[model samples]
Target: MSLEQSSIRDAAIKAPGRRSPAANAPSLESLVSTARALVPRLRERGQQTEIERRVSEETNQLFHRAGFFRLMQPARYGGYEYGFTALLDVISEIGRGCTSSAWACSLGTIHQWLLGLFPAQAQDDVWGKNPRAIMCGSYSPITAAEAVDGGYLIRGKWRFASNVDNSPWAVLGVQLPEENGAGFLLAPRCDWSIEDDWHVAGQAGTGSKTVVIDKPTFVPGHRKLTFAEAASGAPPGAAVNPNPLYSIPFLSAIPVCLVAPLLGTAQGAIDAFVELCENRVTRGGIGGAGARLGQFAHVQSRLADAAAAVDAARLVLDRDITDVELTAAQGRRVSVETRIRNRRGHAYAAKLSHSAVQALFSCVGGSSLALDQPVQRMWRDANAIAQHITLNWDAVSTMVGQHMLGLEPKGAY
Candidate 1:
């Protein structure tokens, strides 16, 4: 589809479930089932999404209809009040079909959950009346915010604001200069403007542009959430929401969003490779193509290994989410070791996903290299996701090793 046509369609597509007056929302299981059912249709639109350089309007509508956005939203504003597992599950399902759509949705949906860590007034302003309002963010300390009388004046630009085109709000990580020392802070979307700067080789549909805030506006005191406060497990919404899910460490849950889509993309590659192998015929050989492909013990072994890796990644993610929810339910803080393990598992999953795609690419032969081939797209998408800093294999492995050996670890956890 043409860019103009896609934009027009996006404008016409109304946002779904904008703070429904009715009470009692559907269960997270029901939401997951619905998302799973939509996978085939979403997969069918993969080419369109890649071509448009963003998720198609129809796919976005389907996700909205499934209440996918509310999986991590606050309950007071008509959200499911579900835990982290639901978010991971939804992203996994979507990623298995279209990596770009899955990537965009995962970033957008998780941003909503992270927004809850901000001040209560900021939460109310964004979701008090519109629970469906999506948000995008850049956690890197790339911007600056000045402390004014009632609020902070933010001025800076954040690159790779994923799903910015589809989101109405954003949170830019900033460094605020104080009399004693500099501190980290979060500034709302209203305080910034978006710059169209995303141009990449893969996951092009995410529309992860650069967000520019050249003295755009001011953020109220209530909306400013400090990085120190977040790390200490204290957020402005704690008094109002009072849900343990809100208390889990942010670093633990955020990386899952980055890795889950890659897992799904790997699954897509496996699926495509399997389908191609089934109908393929060997050229200039006595045996049929399928027979030849199947006859190679090495090929069979790699396929099994790839499948195992994908399943193992999915299992680790689900288990980690469950553990996080359980810790939250107990009203206890997650251990530093546990958090590191979660990151380790996610990074391991990313590595396995990359390995799976590489295996599939090797077995699928020269035909898989075509630009239009599904396997080729999945391969590119998986590799791209694996390159994410959050999924950096070496860093994560070193962190995990440190934790196992009782050494001090760096960064937020």
Candidate 2:
């Protein structure tokens, strides 16, 4: 490693997750209760969110009032500083109502955790004036950055920035012209022009439109986070924030955060399918009149399969996050082996969740294909989520296999 790179890594590891003066934060139980209470409303608004191609303002306000976005934020900044699993649970529950809404919420809220990785001044630039501030991101290195006097001149367009509509600022992944590694550049919302181009078959409510920075914008040095540093399992922010939450491997956490909504999507499918099966009777069948579809062997078997898949997926995901959190609590960095394993496990869980949704969808019958039917929506959302690169089962599985064979795992995990 270069001298600078070595220094960066050393600095990150030395001061990780240091806690600050205790701040009065919301209890996890209350936060969870609020999330549960919002499920029905989210489900009711699912179609509307989809129709609008973004999560509704009303729903956003409800979340803000409920303090849902504060789950992963630093306690020093008026955040709850709750366990990472709590956010996952909240997203999963919300997903049970609307996957698209859950997707937007998860991305929107997780940005708080990401902000904790930036330098203290950068965090201040964001939460100092308004602690309720939320942010969004596009992690692909499509933007260009030129080294300048105070910082770097960044200019480019980034797409698929979920929930950017609800954010005051955004982090765009960029390739630094002077550096060998890629990093993210933080820019205020005013610096970029948003393009309302998001139209998709699934997860449509996420408002993942294009964000364009037409003119070169200067980003200060403190606002940049190198991929190597982020992936190193410690970041510059850890020095000040000192929360185990920020010490989790950035790559590993990425997949985990994205997978929660998919799990909830599958669970929602199961819920809808079971309700349909219980209420609907076969028009004419071998069992005779008044025979419910729930009694059918096919329906029973499919439900069993779907439920099992979701259960297994949740177990895998929960275990991965728990292990990561435990390592951070111990002030230890997660090994590359463990990081790859967790990434692979997360993708596999997502694949399982997708399978569960597919299974439930297949058994939901013809009428459930209607646009308003929750089952159909879950199916579409699940498939769309499965398409994310972090949750690509085939690629992640191969990477895990290569690692098992004593070969260095390939690709950006």
Evaluated with lDDT, which candidate comes out highest? Answer: 2
lDDT string for model 1 (376-395, tens) is 88887887888888888887
TM-score for all predictions? 0.88, 0.92
Find the 10 residues in a row with the least total lDDT in model 2: 12-21
Error of 1 at 85 (Å): 1.2
What tens-digit string does per-residue lDDT give for candidate 2 at 1-413?
55754554344333222222236766556666777788788888888889999887788888888887887788888887765567777788888999988888888788888888888999999999999988888989976789999899987889999987888899889997767779988888889989999999998999999988888888998899888878776799989888777878788766767899999889888888888987987766344457787987878999999999987787666666766776888878888878888888889999999999888778666788888888998898999999998899888888899989999888776
What does the lDDT read for residue 166 in candidate 1?
73
Q: Give the Cα lDDT of each candidate.
A: 0.73, 0.82
Deviation from native of the Cα of residue 229 in model 2, angstroms: 1.2
Q: What would the TM-score be for candidate 2 when compared with the true structure?
A: 0.92
User: Once model 1 is optimally superposed onto the true structure by TM-score, how far is the C-alpha of residue 358 displaced, in angstroms?
Assistant: 1.8
